[model samples]
Target: MFGYVIKRHQLWSGKVLLFPLSSSCASGASGVRFVFGRASAAGTERRTAPAESTGQGEAMYRRKMRGMYISKRALRKHFDPHNYPRETYLLCELQWRGSHKFWQHWLRNDDSKDCHAEKYFLEEIFEPRSYNICDMTWYLSWSPCGECCDIIQDFLEEQPNVNINIRVARLYYTDRASNRKGLRELASSPGVTLEIMDAEDYNYCWETFIQPGVYYRFSPENFESAIKRNCSQLDDILQGLHL
Candidate 1:
C-alpha cells in the first residue's frame, strides 16, 4: 500500500484505483487517466484511467505531467550495467486509431502499490477503449517482466487491431532465463515490436516528455556503452523471433 488516496469511483473490477496520479489530474480532463485495479482474485477485470483533458487547462496540466520525468541526472544514474533502477516508467502515445483517452500519458510502477505502469495500460487504458485499428508507441524505462509479457500477449490476441512499438531503455532481468524467454515470446507476437532505446530515442524522450529548459542534457560520453550493451542483448532476445 503506497498510502495514496483513491479519488475516482471504481467503475471496473481490479485491485488499485488509478486516478489523480497527481491532484491536477482529478479534474478528469482529456489525457488524464482514471484507472482502477486489475481483475480481482475472483476473476474481476481491471480498468485503466483516461488522461485528464489536454484541452482547457493544457499548459498547467503539462507542467504537472512533465514534472514526473524527475531530472536529467536521475535518468543517467540507472543506465549503468552495475546500477539499474528498480522502478519502471512508461511514456506512451496512442495515435489516431481510436485510443482517444489514452492519447499521451506516462505511468510508473515505482509509485504504484502492486502494479507496474504496463498493468495500468493493459487493464485500464487499452482494455476499455480497444479499437479496430490501434497504433501506439511506447518508451519504457525498463523492459517488462515475464508476467506482463503474457498479459500483453493476451491483450494483443483479443484486440488483434492493437499494435505497439515498444522502445525500452534497458532490458529487465536479462540474467534470468524466464525473463529472456518471455521477451522472446513477446517479440514473436505479430503486433509488437521491441527494441532498445538508442541515444536518439533518449533525446526524443527528453525533448518531448521532460519539462522544457529545466534540465540540461548530459554529455555524449554518458550512457553510450550502456546503450550498445542493451542493444546487443535486445537483438539477441529477438534474433529469430521477428516476423
Candidate 2:
C-alpha cells in the first residue's frame, strides 16, 4: 500500500517477512530484509517514474485516494467474518522497468456486467513485459474472490517476469470452499505472496496514501486484536481447510 514490494521473498528467505504461515521462522536474504525497513513495507517509496495524473492512471492522489481510503470502522465492518460489502477495492503499487507506478480501482459496471478492479490493473493499466523484472504490492480491501483468484492465476502465469505481494484488509468469504481453495492455490503460486493486513499495514496505507506528512493516528481499542484475529484466519486459510 504505502511502502513496498518483495514478491514472496519470505518464500526465498526462511524469515516470516511480514506474516507467518507457520511457527518456523529464520532469516535469509539481506537485500530483501534491507528493503523492508519496517514491518511489511519498503523503507522508501520506489517512484522512479512519476504517477500519471490524467488519462487512465487515476492519479487523483489525495482526491481519489481519500475517496478510496478505507476507515478503521469500515475495516471492522467488512473485516468481520459475518459481514462484508459485495465489492472490492485495490490499492496497488508496481515497480516495472525501473519505474514505480501507483493506481487504484474498484469494480465497475459496464453494460450490467461487473468489471473487477484487478482486471483494470492487469488488462488496462499495465502492459505485459517479459524482459525486466516486475514487482507488485497490493493492498486489497477484500481478498481476491475465487473467480478473481483464477483470473490472477492466469495473469501471473502469463507474466512469468511478474511477482505479486498481496496484503488484504479482510478475508473474503473464507467460509465458502471455492474461495478458500482459490486463496490456498494463490498462496502456493510460485511468484505470489499473500498476507492479512496488520496494524503496521494499516498505518503504512494511511501514511503513504491518505495523509502523508500528518501525525500518525491512533487505532481503535479493538483494532489490534481484530488484526490478530484476521491474521489467524488468513494463516488458517493458507495452513488449514478451516477459516
Candidate 3:
C-alpha cells in the first residue's frame, strides 16, 4: 500500500515532518518515525510564477484568426466581382464521377505574399492531388494574365486526364502585343475550353458553386444584371485593344 500524509499545522508552525512506514507496521500503530525540518516564514508563504506571454505566439494566433476570417469572407464574396474590381479572382470547382461532393479552391491575385495565385495553386493544390479522373471548371472574374496563361498551358500538358474549362467575366487583353497574342494562343489550346461566361453560366456558377447557403437573397435576376454590366465593361476594354 502507498500513502502520503500532509500536516498543514506543522507546515504553518514553521516545521514539516515526513515519514515512510514499513509494510510490517499495523494500520493504527503509533511511534511512526519522521524526518523533520524547520520552516522559515518566507518559505511558508506561497508564491506563484506568473504566466509568460510571448509576443510572437500571440501574433501568430492573431494572424491565424485573421486568415480564417478573411477566407470565410472571401467564400461569401467569391462570385461578386465588386470585391476585387481591379484584381483577378479565380474559383475552381473539381468534380469526379460517382461522387456528389466536389472540391473548390478560390484564388485571388494577392492571396499569397510571394507568388501569384496560379503558382500557389500549382504548388500547393495541384501537386498534392492523386491521379483521378476529374473535370475542373475555372470561373474567373477576369481572364488569366499572360504568365498564368503559360502556367495553365503547361499544367494541362502534364495532366491529360484532367479536363479544364475556363469561363471568364472579362477578357484580359492589354495594348501590349505579347499579351494579346498570349490570350489568343491560350484560347486555342488543346484539351482546354476558354469562353466568356454568358448570363446563364454566370448565374449557374454563382448559385451552384459558390457559397450558396450564405447568400440567401441571391437571385438569377441579380446575377444576370451583374453579368451584363461586366460584359459591357469587358466589351469596352476589348474594343480599346482593337482585338
Q: How far off is residue 82 in model 1, in Å?
A: 6.8
Report the lDDT tens digits of candidate 2 across residue range 150-198. 8888987887767788888778777898899889988888778888776
- Per-candidate local distance difference test: 0.57, 0.54, 0.47
- Candidate 3 structure quality by residue, lDDT tens digits, 1-243: 111221111122334433332332211101111112221111111113332221111000011111212233443355454444654556566644333344444545543243455554554344222334445677776777778878877876676545677777655555655555556666667657766677666565554444334545444455566567766754544445445
Ranking by TM-score: 1, 2, 3
Best by lDDT: 1
Candidate No. with top TM-score: 1
Model 2 poorest 10 in a row by lDDT: 24-33
Query: Which of candidates 2 and 3 is the stronger one according to lDDT?
Result: 2
Greater-lDDT candidate between 1 and 3: 1
Candidate scoring better on TM-score of 1 and 2? 1
Model 1 stretches with alpha carbons more than 4 Å out = 1-82, 98-102, 110-112, 127-131, 240-243
Give each model a TM-score.
0.66, 0.61, 0.54
- Cα lDDT tens digits, model 1, 170-232, are 888777777888899987888788887777777765665555676465553477898888888
What's the lDDT for residue 208 in model 1? 54
Model 2 segments more than 4 A misplaced: 1-83, 97-112, 211-221
lDDT of 3: 0.47
